[model samples]
Target: MSEIQKALVVHAEEAERIGLPHGGGFRLLADGRDTGGALGANRLSLGEGAAGARPHFHALSTELFHVLDGVVRFTLDGVTSIVAAGGLVSVPPGTPHSFGAAPGSAAELLVVLTPGVDRFGYFRALGRIQHGLGTFDDLLPASEQDRYDVHFV
Candidate 1:
């Protein structure tokens, strides 16, 4: 860990864990504020056939993914590729992209966004919706896209 990491690392128990079915949930490891806007990161564990991110673009941030287990299917721009454990992929700002666990496979991936945007609220809403505690309506208005940092394409 770098000096910055030593100061900012989010310990496992300290991390915010979001629940989901079949072990597909998110663990927020770090957010923009924690890293002083250097980056945002989280661990995503997905089950077979679990839906992942929809096509979206970060107008001002780059997104990265590192598969740690199983296979993940990433659709970058107009192409799709299956990345297995140990694979890494990075998408620059403005690139339309999406990702999910490959059909019939389970996966875990580390996701990071550079010059990070605070997306904890957005992700929390996702957990709520998935578990029936809330509706998609809870996310926010499209007009507030800049606030949440996700612009579905």
Candidate 2:
């Protein structure tokens, strides 16, 4: 029998293991190497004061953020914009961008990274840090971040 390889069969414990905590921050439904898919997709939920991600630039992929609830503050190429519920923001490739939840409010959104999907591993590793499963300094050296195809924006 051919071995079946896939990700996404996640339970609460499994979700917690792969960088998701119960009702915390984000949940990754599919990543680059998981399920043999090319696109990196994730469902992110940021509570008050939570930043969506480190401001960074992708050398070769465009990103899109579709808000599901609440308000989100998105910064693209140094300009910040507020997106309300059901709004979507698209950041063109090579733009320096990031997002965060509004202070004292919550936000849920979908994030998609195209072209370079393996980049998802960085976030997964970061999740390990968030879960107290590992220690990463406040800043991850460019050497490490570059391995996951990220660069300072």
Candidate 3:
């Protein structure tokens, strides 16, 4: 099938290969193939008291985020910045960064990972660990977090 056909035929049911983790308090909205090319777009909606992804670096990729609603507090290279509605932020490759919505408010944001990194696999692994629905410890070892270049403070 053509790429467009592939995309259009994708239903929410077939997209069940992954889901957000328990602690994440967010629902993920894209699969690895959604990007179609170098650009991959995903979204995370934060609930009250919810934080975003773990601090991570993409040695071979870059990312951009556009805050659609609510307040988001994000960190870049240890520096904290708040992104409110209609705000945009960009992070270059190899930069350590993470984001979270302010307490008691809902936040909506679009996250685009360029050159798409291994995000699909990372999130799938996270869901496995968080939900206990499956086992995938062999895929993502805690000791080799740096191998993925993801770190937490």
Q: Which parts of model 3 are misplaced by more than 4 Å?
A: 1-36, 132-153
- Provide the TM-score for each candidate, comma-separated: 0.91, 0.75, 0.69
Q: What is the C-alpha RMSD of each candidate to the true structure, in Å?
A: 3.2, 4.5, 4.7
Q: Relative to the unseen true structure, what is the C-alpha lDDT of residue 121 in candidate 3, on a scale of 0 to 100?
A: 59
Model 1 Cα lDDT, one tens digit per residue, 1-153 = 544544775789998999886678999998887787889999999998677888888898999999999999999998999999999999998999998899999999999999887888888889988988987665557755687778788
**lDDT, candidates in the order shown:** 0.87, 0.71, 0.66
Which order, best to worst by lDDT? 1, 2, 3
lDDT of 2 by residue, 1-153 (tens): 855765456454444223345344556655667655456777788777577677888776778889999899888898999998999998877788888887777888878777546655677677777788776663368766566656665
Q: What value does the lDDT take at residue 96 in candidate 2?
A: 89
Clash list (residue pairs), candidate 1: none
Taking all chains together, the TM-score of candidate 3 against the true structure is 0.69
lDDT of 3 by residue, 52-127 (tens): 7767766656788998888898899999998899999999988899888877767888777676544555566666
Q: Which is the leading candidate under lDDT?
A: 1
Q: How many residue pairs clash in each candidate?
A: 0, 0, 0
Q: After superposition, which runs of candidate 1 have C-alpha atoms over 4 Å from their true positions? A: 1-6
